[model samples]
Target chain A: MKRYMPLFVLPTLCAFILGFILPFIMGVGLSFCKFTTVTDAKFVGFSNYIKALQDTVFRHSFWYTALFTVVSLLVINVIAFALAMALTQKMRGTNIFRTIFFMPNLIGGIVLGYIWQLIFNGILAKYSTALALNEWYGFWGLIILVSWQQIGYMMIIYIAGLQAIPGDVLEAAQIDGATGWQRLWKVTVPMMMPSITICSFLSVTNGFKLFDQNLSLTAGEPGKMSEMMALNIYNTFYGRTGWEGVGQAKAVLFFILVVIIGVLQLRATRSKEVQQ
Target chain B: MKKKKVMPVLLAAAMTVGMFAGCGSNDAGTAGGSTQGAQGTQAADKSSGDGSVYYLNFKPEADEQWQILASEYTKETGVPVTVLTAASGEYEKTLKSEMAKTDAPTLFQVNGPVGLASWKDYCYDLSGADVTGQLTSEDFALKDGDQTLGIGYVIESYGIIYNKALLEKAGYTAADITNFASLKKVAEDITARKDELGFSAFTSAGMDGSSDWRFKTHLANLPIYYEYKADGIDNTDAIKGTYLDNYRQIWDLYINNATCDPKLLSTKTGDDAVAEFATEEAVFYQNGTWAYNDVKDLGDDNLGLLPIYIGVDGEENQGICTGTENYWCVNKNAAPEDIQATLDFMNWCVTSETGVNAMCKDMGFVIPFKSNLDSENVLVNAANDYLDAGKTPVTWNFTTMPSEEWKNGVGSALTAYAADQSDANWDAVKKAFVEGWATEAAAAK
Candidate 1:
């Protein structure tokens, strides 16, 4: 079994190289050139990256995306944990309620975005203004949308982690005369580190990578003040002239940021994992 | 603890499997190719009899007529004709991507100078061709010295389209207004009696891509006085601060005296503006000459279209905003046979009886051609009389080569103006207009 590790990893290795590594390499190489079509590209280095970094819109979008991700991570995890706590008990229709709550996650991001746009706008229309009228409306609108989409998924993870705790731990805590709050804060939560880590990682990464919903929801309206980082990178690459390399650089930076944060988080949470 | 780790890993594996399963096919690249069949694939697979013509038309109004011709061509020559129309204002972006495909539309529009530069690499010239004789003016030809890249199928005009009944109710006739003062006075009077007249002076002057042309092109033309003076002789660039103050005279009246709020109008969609104009809710529409056909169908004979007499120093010398509303340019990257087939179809449209008559009915008028349009085509003929009277038309500054970023930059500036009705915003528009031209000019370098 130990000797078959190479064979076991072969499929994933090939898929990763083909789908991610090759495209990334090609994208990086192409960033130095300027051409409408890939075959016709002409070398125009550093200029593209310089233009992108200097672009005021790209800078603004970076800040916007950072703010949105921080806010969304907090909201999604808190709600998911609460739901997971409620669902862990022996409740009626628990299975059905869990499935129902998870259904939104099954819907495609683009479809969900358009549907919510209709709902939000239909309500906002009475005021004779649109979601794009103000940046605050756009920010809160995206927060609500992302939270609604991701909460159930994180909840399921939290539930699984909660159930994995040993029954003896609770019994031992009761025998020690510990309160419910104290056990929840110490034993249960510390034991649940792995699940909390996974959920946090997903929510953070998803917040950073959000694209389709942002695109369909506002399309960076109110004069592009509400454009997020991913959408900003996309617009910069395609929308502006001589900015493709810069968008690519920004993407590279984004990858580094997410990786660093994810690694730090996993390290912090895994340190708290019990010796079970 | 072992179950906790194993179950989450299994779920992750399940999701990964599900994703790959959804995209099981190896050739996802080919999925983008199935649309608008290869430009000349039919021609290559078979003879000219089987050679299809794929025209990606920019003008939406010509769809019905093109449909008739496409069916007729297929019936007559056994070659299929597919005409695809872009939704209004999305033509440039559509053209760029559509031209990139392996089976992209064989025949696509390269309408003007901006289009000529952006698309010239992909455009095959039409110099000294049979279709060249069909144009009313050789001026419609978009060329880079010798490379005649595009020409007009139908030359359209633009100015003030108005409701004749609404004018009469305001105690005026078409004869009563021939210049800017009278037009402004009539608008003021009509606006004063808005409660009685059931409408205001002008329609909503939205500064979105849809209605900004009324300011950027038509109304802006009044100050330049149609002499093509914006950039001077051979200085092909957008109009800067040359006569921006003069442009403001009518623009102020347009937004302030209009029926709707400026901010509300800023947020209004194109459909709302067109609908309000069509329902006879307003007396005047600052639009192109192509509107005659749609306005006629509103079931009202009282609606009349004319050029605005907005104040110009030399008023009598000015006529309607006359030029090619759009142009037809063949794709240079196209297969030689398909390009020939497209040219054949184009020639047939201008020369053949059925094609000319069909275009006349569809486009609301016909261009000056050897085939000659039926005399009964009144809306277009009325527009032609303005050109025939020798009143110089608005020099469509469209022929000036703009950087590819020009349109988006202009759109952004115009959108800003719509949001905040301030002179500072107007100055930003001017800067974008001028600087954007210089930037694009530099890029094309």
Candidate 2:
């Protein structure tokens, strides 16, 4: 088995180098240059990073994305957990309810955004305003849209975690005069830490990396007040002329920020896991 | 046991090798197939060899006609002409990627001077070319120093398109409105009688992304044009916004007497406005000659254009805003033979009888070429009438707009203002127009 390891690993290693590592290295290099095309790049030191940091719009998007990530992470996880718990209980038609709840996750992000836009606009029309007219409206609109699309996906993960809990452990807790709430917190939750870690990591990263839904829903309208970091980076790269390097620099910073947050979240959640 | 272990190892090796072979064969198959297809086409007609034309067309509306024209050219000259039209609003991005390819576009388009700046390095000098000679005026040719970089192909005009019968029914005629004052009077009267008339004065001034360009860029051009006219300049680094107050009045009139509430305009699309004009729910729609196909079902006589009157001094002489953003540029990076072929093809497009008719009659373009044919488009004829009447056509200054971000900023501000219609909101629009422009202009530098 050890002798065949190199042969099996070679293909995946080559693919990773070609697809991810090479482009990532190139991206980091390009962030320090002024260029319209890669071939015409000229070294420009830290000017691009300076410009990216100095941009008020970019700073605003940073804070906006941070708040959005935190709120959406909490909302999606809580609702998903609740739904997972409910569906796991002994009940008829649980499969049907789960499938129905999970349907939105199957739809493309752009399609979901437009569908929700029509629905939201239809309801908001009675108030004589629209989702694109105000910043807060766009923010909350994105929250509702993302939650609607992502909650079911998280719910599936939570359900798997709930099902993986040993029945005997809960029975033991019940025989020991433990209440349902005590059993859930002391036994079920600590055992569910690994799944919680994965779920939180996914939700947080997804919240920060969101682009297509943000674009199709509002497109950072009402003076780009709702522009997230990814969309802002995209706009900087594509929308503005001569801002490609700054966009690349923003992307690098965004990558670092997400990594730090994800690592910290994983570490915090992993510590709470108890052995069965 | 050794034989069993060796059999599994061999199987694993075979599977891994098969995976690689699968990917390799797939790529090779597609590449070989494409080359074979190209060879098949080339073998069909072997004349006019070594100089195929590849035009990266900018306009999606004219794509089908361009394809027909390309095939026609190919049949006659036996030069393979490939026409690839970028999706609407994706031309710049497409052009950038395409230009980097080995077989880059031999022919492409630039919007105006601002568009030419980035592509200027790639543009072949059209000086002394037959196509440059065929241009109606030097103004239609975009030049940098001594070299002609691009030539304007089409001249489009936009104004207030009105329903002729509806105007007469409201006790008004095209001749009754000469300036902003009379236009305002007639529009206000129609609004006053809107309950009895069963139709509003103007179509909804939609602020959706699809519709907002009519206001943010085209409508915004009026103020920019007037400012330039006042400044006695063709281009400027910063705009003083001298005619913004007049801009305010025209915008206010459009929203106040429209088919829908001002607040509801944010969700209204271009199609909604066209539907309103087409169904006779509104009398006036703010659009251009390109809208002829959309509303021509109403008949030629029913369609008439009025120059957008934004209440300026001596403004009765203000003709429709007329200019071309579509300028054909030859790629300097292409092979010499391909360059000549592209040049010859362009000259033939404006010169040959089949080319002129296809462009004018079939495509509905008012091409700015000496050998251009008469267009049957009524809105185009109306625009020519204004020019013939000696009214000064407002040039398209929006082409000089610093960036798309500036346009989006203005559009967003305009959308917000339309929803609330407050003084503070209007101030924000002005700030977006003025400060946003300055910021973008500086950033572009």
Candidate 3:
């Protein structure tokens, strides 16, 4: 088996290098150059980066995305955890409830954005306003949209973690005269740290990389005040001529920021995991 | 146990080999299929003595007509012509990605000089081409120094399209409203009697993406046109919005007299406006000749075109806005035979009887070529009447707009102002129009 490792690994290695690694490297290189098409690139060094940073819209989107990620991460994880706890208590018809809750996750982001747009506009029309008229409306609209789509998925992960808890451990806590809340906090939560780490990491990263929902919901309307980082980069790349290099630079910076944040979050959460 | 171990190993080895075979066969299959396809086309081209044509069309509304025309041309001439239309509002993005392909478009279009700037290197000079000779006027040809980079194919006119029957019921004729002052008086009168008359003065000035271009680009063009006329310039890097107040009055008229609440305009669509006019729920609709198909059910005699009167000084002699954003250009990088074929096809499109009929009648386009046939479209005939009367048609200077981003900024400002109707919001619209233009223009440089 050991000797056959090279043969087994070669196919996947080739695909990874060709599909992901090469384009990623080329993208980073192009960030420092200005060109419409890849064949016509001319190196301009830090100018692209300077232009990206100088853009007030880009800066606004960065802060907007940061707040969105933090708020969404907390909301999604807390509600999903609570739902998982309730559903795992030998409740009747839990499967039906779980399926119903998870159905929204199966819908496409663009579709969800449009459906919710109609619903939100229909309600807001009573007030004689629209979602695109104000930035805060767009912000809260996206938050609600994303939370609806992602909460079900996170709940499934939490459910899996809950079901995996050893029965004997809870029995031991009970024998020690532990109450339900105490058993949950001391024994179950400590034991569930591994799952918590994985769930948090996924939710945090997903919150930052969100684009389709943000785009279809508001499209950075009311003068681009609702744009997030990913959508901002996309608009820069496609919407503005002579700004492709700046868009590429923004993408590279976005990648680095997401990576650093993801790493720090993993480290913080992984340290809390206790051995079974 | 040894047999089981060997069987599992054999299965694993087979699975890996199958994966390799799958990858290898896909590459080989595509390579062979494409080469075969290329050879087949080459053989057909050789037999026909002409290269194939691939036209990347810009208009989605005329896509079906283009497809039929292409098939007919191919049948008659034995030259393969493929037509692909980009989705509405996605032409530039589609063009950029398509131009990067190996089998890029042989024939394409640019909006105007600003659009031609990015694709200048890709454009084949049409100065001495047969299609260039067919153009009715040099004004329709986009030039760069000595080279004719593109030729305007369709001439479209946009203004306040009104229902003649509805206007008569409101006790006014088309002649009674020749300028802004009279137009305003009539519209205000209609609005005052809207409840009794069972129709409003104008359709909803929708601010949704589908309808906002009517205001942001077409309506916005009025101010730019007046400024350009004052400066005696065709294009400008920075705009002095001299006629913005006129723009404000026209916008105010449209929203205040409309069939819907101003606050709900952002949710309305182009379809809504057209429906309002077609169903006779409104007296006026701000759109172009292309909207004829949507509202033609009201009968030809009931329709008329009125020049958008925005209270400009010259006023009475102003015709409807008549210009084009669609300009055809052959790709310079195509094979020489393909380039020649594209040029020949373009000339045939403008010169041939079948082509002219298809364009003018079927597509309802007022083509800008010498062989252009008479249009049956009522709105088009109305436009020609304006031109015949020697009214100064406002040229489309909106083509020189810096970018789509600038339009969006102004559009949002306009929508916000529509919702609030405040001075500060109107000031924001002015800032977006003037300052955003300057910023975008400098960035484009």
Point out the higher-scoring one by lDDT: 1 or 3: 3
Question: Predictions ranked by DockQ, top down?
Answer: 2, 3, 1
lDDT of 3 by residue, A91-161 (tens): 69999989987889999999998889889889999999999899999888988998899888989999999
Top-down TM-score ranking:
2, 3, 1
Better of 1 and 3 by TM-score: 3
Tell me how far the alpha carbon of residue B194 in candidate 1 is from the true structure, in angstroms, after superposition: 2.8
Question: How accurate locally, in lDDT, is each candidate?
Answer: 0.70, 0.87, 0.87
Question: What pairs collide in candidate 2?
Answer: none
Specify the poorest-scoring 10-residue window by lDDT in model 2 chain B: B28-37
Model 1 scores a TM of 0.79
TM-score each candidate: 0.79, 0.93, 0.93
- lDDT by residue for model 1 over B135-229, one digit each (tens)? 76767677788878887666666777777887788789877777777777888888889998898878887654456556655565455443345
Please give the lDDT score at residue B207 for candidate 1.
53
For model 1 chain A, give the 10-residue run with minimal summed lDDT.
A236-245
lDDT of 2 by residue, B1-445 (tens): 6877888678767876866775564321122111222211221242456687888877778777887888888888878777777777777866766676666778989999888876788899999999999888999999899899999999999999999999999999999999999999999999999999999999999988789999999999999998887888987768777888888899999999999989988788999999999999999999999999999999998999999999999999999999999999999988999898899899889999889989998898999999888889999999999999999998998999988889999998888888888999999989999988899888877
DockQ of 3: 0.53
